[model samples]
Target: MEITNDLNSTFSPYSTTNVNATAAPNCTDWPHVPMTTLIPAIYSVICVLGIVANALAVCVLAHSSASRRTVANTFMLNLCVSDLLFLLSLPLWAVYYSQGYNWPFGNIACKVCGALHNLNLYASIFFITSMSADRYLAIVHPLQSQSARDPKRARLTCILVWVLAFACSVPTFYLRSTQHVEALGVEACAIHYTSDTWFYTLTWLKIILAFLLPLLVISCCYGAIGRHLLAGTGLLRIHPSTNAPSFKSQESCCSKPEKPLTPQQCVNKGSSSSGGRGGGRQLEGRGLERVLWTVAAVVVSFFCCWFPFHCVTFIDLLHGGDPMASCWAQWTIKNLTPLTLCLGFSNSAINPVLYCFIGNHFRGRLGGLCKGLCACLKARGEDHSHQRGSFSTRLSSFSRKLSDLKDLAIAEPSGSA
Candidate 1:
């Protein structure tokens, strides 16, 4: 992930040019052109777009009553906030790249921005993991999951997540600083780990902890959910007796009948049908649960986006000591690396869209909005005289009621005697 900037002036302490002929090799032709050109442009666009998208997601989730105040949604909100904070540093990066690695931003900004970026990385992964755990509990252990479903516990869990994310990000603060590369003239705010070993180890660790472990957890949870749903659906199909009459029809038939019937007909046969219909409804709910297993999809997307970037980084670390690599190989790696990393970074902005797709309430709200807009336009054209008067009054009342609701929703509920 580290791209070398303009570093022509200063001689390396280990350089062989002065004394030892083979002590250290020169890396003068390492494909800086593409790294200087394409990578920055791509990252700049991604950073801006990601910030805007994630910010909007936070606002919508915070404001929308349809978004249930669940532990998962709470984590998602925090995740969006983290992403926004991380993106705030991107403009500095854009500036740095535009000036060809000349960083005007001071040392403190470098450390802070670097830390924020890493914090978001850890926070985003952990939140996704938390969400998958929540899903697993809700699906696999519905009866026992009630206690864990409490919002208070969820809040505690989130607090812990933040703490852990911060702890994991502490290294970035220490490792990132303004390096005075004389060749570049201006200082380059870059991650300058003390040793290559430290960098490679941490990089691999991130791949394992943030990417691999979380992916496994999400995949397992969704897999279990899918199996449960399949089993339930199969059970419903096998048990025809459990799919009889609709609940409402059964209840009506159970009431006093005007017409006479046979002795056996005296029994409420409708009740049996109702019970079967109820079971079928439950099976349908299980099917919906299966569809909600998009956590796996999210994890897959994360891997797809990040794996290439990480692989390149690993390759670079292995051969970084070598100073005479082919220009084509270097150029190919440099160009492809940023594209992959940008894809990974895009995950922050995509989660809310996934929520809208998976959540029934969001879909319903969108449908309602479309319907309301059409109604309003139609009413505008026609003489809604009778409708207009009543609708206006009702709308005013609704507005006032909504104002009250907004207050209540924003305010923390107070305990009463």
Candidate 2:
């Protein structure tokens, strides 16, 4: 029977690095040692760090008070959850590749792991896109989006994303299985498609739904936000005196003033006309710069990590050549595939740093939470110390009373004698 399967490169079944004995003689020269060694090691590191970082993020977000909650924070919390779901499956993939594409885990394990992997791909991107949308609304349509940006609505949106992501992953859970490759004499955990149509359909779906669509949405949001900020900055730079009509209107209003201005009002007008606008603009510019930096970091990191993998997938789909027969295919499978896969996996690991740790507001909240925890711990410690001291005092007094009674009993015996 002709077989097609994949370990972790989307749902594509053709893997040049997989240990298949049917490859062409020249293609057989592809090095397996580096792939087996480095994939497991890098996967292990990513899994561990990703888990810890995301877990901490979950805890912090979960414990945050309602008053402190916002749409962005809610999306970030869900993003962390999505990364964690994917990170949970990394160790199994690590071991699978480490053992030369052999899957020790049974069929069910394979399905569960694959499903989790699928979940992360959709969930993470969706959550990120949602965050970008929330920011766009906040910066560009602050007053208009107030009702839409409520924390309750954000939580509901997160629930919808999770459900949608799970729905996307349902196919993976059902179709994934462990097949024993006769050529290699090992069971490999991968999706087995009975037909080419299903294989291509799913692969295209992953690329389009998970990567391209989100990228497009993110670009539109940030692009609009950037233009809005630039426009506002331009307005801030233009002095009121530069506009003849507005200056004339202000002069007319001043000419018919009903009451004499107070000293405080005069001082405020002087400051506003002189230095206040400049100072305000300077502050606004700094805030805008921070927002741009954050947006750039998120977009750049995302592209760097997932773009290569998607590019390879796209090219492979277009190439439509036999991996063992084509030199370009062989080179890609041996070289670009592993690097891109590693990059894609590392994205989950660094998300906490990129999304949450870099945000000044997030840092402030985290710091406040840490301080509160420390204070609570300190209070508990002090209470425990007081209880211990009181217990010791009571015990000492009881011991002394018992000794006195014994002494009195001995004296009574002696006197009776």
For each candidate, the alpha-carbon lDDT, in order, equals: 0.58, 0.68
TM-score winner: 2
Which has the greatest lDDT?
2
- Model 1 misplacement above 4 A: 1-33, 64-67, 232-296, 320-335, 363-417
Can you tell me which runs of candidate 2 are displaced by over 4 Å? 1-22, 28-33, 232-285, 321-324, 410-417
The digit string of per-residue lDDT tens for model 1 on 28-92 reads: 67545444566568667877778766766666557655325655667667777877887777777
How big is the positional error of residue 75 in model 1, measured in Å on the Cα after superposition?
A: 1.5
